[model samples]
Target: MKKANKLLKEIVVLIFALLFLSPIYIVFANSFKDRGELYESVLALPSSYSFQYYLQAMERMNFISAFGNSLVVTAVSIFFLVILSSMTAWMLARTNNKLSKIIFMSFIATMLIPFQTIMMPLIQFMDQIMRLTNIPMLNTHGGLIFMHIGFNSALSIFLYHGFITTIPKSLEEAATIDGCSKFMLFWKIVLPMLKPITVTVIILNVIQIWNDFLLPSLVLTSPGLRTIPLTTFYFFGQFTIQWNLAMAGLTLTLIPIVIFYLFAQKHIIKGIGEGAIK
Candidate 1:
């Protein structure tokens, strides 16, 4: 009876896994096909695997430029988010006072507010700042990075705050006794110990910023500044969608983050688990 139950559970789990993976399979399999093949058999595996479509899409989309734009935005945003949030969380954790608590709570509270509600106002605010300072906020990569940092900071700080509190003050005390400055102590001792949660924060932000299309669409209007997701729009038009090239382009787009996530995925779980428990 127990064996039969176990077998049934396995079957059910396998069914769900297959259902989840079906879309990926379809996209990956169709990427090598042409329009006729895609139309004739959407689910059928390709007769021949070829890189021609990918090469064509890459040439048309200016894949290198689009890729560089995305890399710059995502990397720069994550860099600031990690450094600033880590420092902020450490300070908040170390300061034992009501004001610190209030500030920390404020960061947490901001996470509750949906971005959609304030997006219009945020754009207006950026425009106002741009007009005032003559800084290019709209139609620029800098603007998109600025927004990514703002939107992702709350969660990164939350994660860091939780994990920072778990760190023993004794370490900092010993470092201080050895003639370490506050900045050096954090850089040398505290930051090194934050590897687990740092990895978690990176994974989260990478996925968020890399995949985000709406905010980029709003902030960046120049064709030259288009990120990977924005470039995917080229494959789409008023009438017809180029499924073959679209699928290939999407496959290329997915490769970087997918490879990144697959490699660092275990760290994500590790970080979250450690942060939660300790």
Candidate 2:
């Protein structure tokens, strides 16, 4: 009876999984079909698969440039976020002072505030800073990356703080007794031990920053600086929508992140499991 119940549960979960994935499947299938076939039957298999829409979308969207811009922004933002958040969390974890506790709590508190509430004010502040300093904060990759770091740091710091607390302080003490400096101790001893949580942080931030649309849309105005999501808007127009082209563009945009997740999924799962245990 127990085995039967487990099997039945698995079957139910599988059904739900398929249901969740149906929209993605529909988009992928329709991407290969022409407009008429897509409109006629979205769920049906394409009568003949063709890459024409993909080719057209790629050309119209300037996929290569947009892809490069996204890669640069995501990579730079995650790099700084991981380094800064990890160090900040490590400090918070090791220090038991009231100030540290208050600061850590402050980071956690920011996570409760919705991004939508601050979106307009954030943009205005950036614009004001740009005007005051004569800096190109808007319509620039650096500006977008800076915003990503600010927005993503709270969660990253929280995750790192939780994981760092689980680590033994004796490890740092031992390193110190051997004459290792604080920086070296952290770099050689503590950071390596933080692999599991670090992987989780990287994967989470990568996906968030890479697929972000609204933030990028508000920050990036130049056509040359558009990300994949912004570039996909080319398929949309006032009078008519290029559904087939839009689908193809979406498929292309999804492929990179899907491939990245597939490659890193094992590490991600392992990190989460280990972090949970710790």
- lDDT by residue for model 2 over 1-278, one digit each (tens)? 99999999999999999999999999899888887887798899999888998998888888999999989999999999988999999988998999999999998899889879989999999999999998888899989999999999988898899888877799899889999998998899988998878898888788789888999999988888999878876446421477777888889888997888788889867766654554
Each model's C-alpha lDDT? 0.87, 0.87
TM-scores, all models, native as reference? 0.88, 0.88
Off by over 4 Å in 1: 1-16, 271-278
Candidate 1 residue-wise lDDT, 1-278, digit = tens: 99999999999999999989899889899989888888898899999999998998788787899999999999999999999999999999999999999999998999889889989999999999999999999988888898899899989989999888877899899989999999999999989998878888888888789888889988988889999888877545421467787778778888887788688778867765764564
lDDT: worst 10-residue window of model 2: 232-241
Query: Candidate 2, overall lDDT?
Result: 0.87
Positional deviation of 230 in candidate 1, in angstroms? 1.5
What local lDDT does model 2 show for residue 21? 91
